[model samples]
Target: MSTTPDRVALVLGGSGGIGRAVSERLAADGMAVAVHYAGNKGRAEEVVTAIDAAGGAAIAVGGDVADENDMRAAFEAVETAFGGVDVVVNTAGILILKPIAEFDLDDLDRMHRTNIRGTFVVAREAANRVRAGGAVVNFSTSVTRLQMPTYGGYVASKAAVEGMTLILARELRGRDVTVNAVAPGPTATPLFLDGKDEATIANLAKAAPLERIGRPEDIAEAVSYLAGPARWVNGQVLFTNGGIA
Candidate 1:
């Protein structure tokens, strides 16, 4: 693992399940964390409270990742609080599931705006601002590989992230910064498992070789690994699923 004693980390979408988990993990690993949320100030504050309770340094900020001005301001907030950013984790996204024929154009635009454009906004900023030996981690999903029905638009958006990650990694060569993505399968998060019946959830779990759905912590573990220990890993889309795909 490569680490600077006083490095800072920024997590976009830090109020959601996977984002919150990653924020806590990085803070535990000794980085001051700036937790960014899109809408829920309360949820973002909750994550900061948890980190503070655990004796880790963290603060909450709000921004819409798709907006460049908002993202720039969020970075400014992080830099002001913790010096400068060394790690950036983007987990902000929206999922609207429907068959293609029934898909709403409005929903499609919203998903693309957040998932694809937001990723670029953050990545572009990180590429220029992150210090030497910093890391940038983007989020993708296993559904891109699973090709599940009714996920065409969502998967398509994430696929753009995957492509961008590879190009960014190459572009950052010799900068001593690693860029990568984590793709988790069917995690047990509010966004993922909120309304499913027990039987349906269990069946989905059984489909994986691990016979259980993933936890936010499971995905967080992967992010921590890449952000800290996996210095040689770059331009990779790590599938953090339990061999389901």
Candidate 2:
């Protein structure tokens, strides 16, 4: 394979499962990654150390993705570290499951704060700071399509993410940046499998044609492709689910 150019990426929530995988994958693919974490600096540092051990470049940055000033500083830190950023993958989010009638207003607010407003803040910074030919990848969940009963609030927030992703692509018409979302199905992450029983997990896995849960690496592969070489794929929500639809 030909060598990849010197590129930089800032992955929000890079300390988490899917985010960490994306951080490692992008670094392996020859990009200097800025691993951004909201509350887990140690985990972010671990990712950076692992990348460095593998002869790749990475740095740990911390901030609230919902805070504009914080996210702006993050973008600046990445630019200062690696010249400029070429890709931004926002994996920062929160999940609270409850029936619509049983949902606490506070829970709905929190979910929207991270998943909706947080995405806008991150995308705003990326829109202004990312170099030409860069890509912005946001995260969504396949639950929006599955339309499960208890997923009302969670699915609502992701629907907003999908809307913004497509609109942002149109807004960046001349800048050559691709804006997209990755809506992953049931993945085997701590955040995903936390409260579920084995039986429930098995049912979800079997629902998909692949008959298995998605690995963090599987979603990371999609992010890597969009960040590096999937230029023609713009303004779309790529469902990395195993044919769950």
Q: Mind sharing the TM-score for model 2?
A: 0.97
lDDT string, candidate 2, 63-118, tens digits: 99999999999999888777898999999999998899999999899989999999
Off by over 4 Å in 2: 1-5
Clashing pairs in 2: none
Query: Backbone clashes per model, in order?
Result: 0, 0
Give a tens-digit lDDT track for model 1, residues 148-172: 9999999999999999999999999
Clashes in candidate 1: how many? 0
Question: On a 0 to 100 scale, what is the lDDT of residue 11 in model 2?
Answer: 96
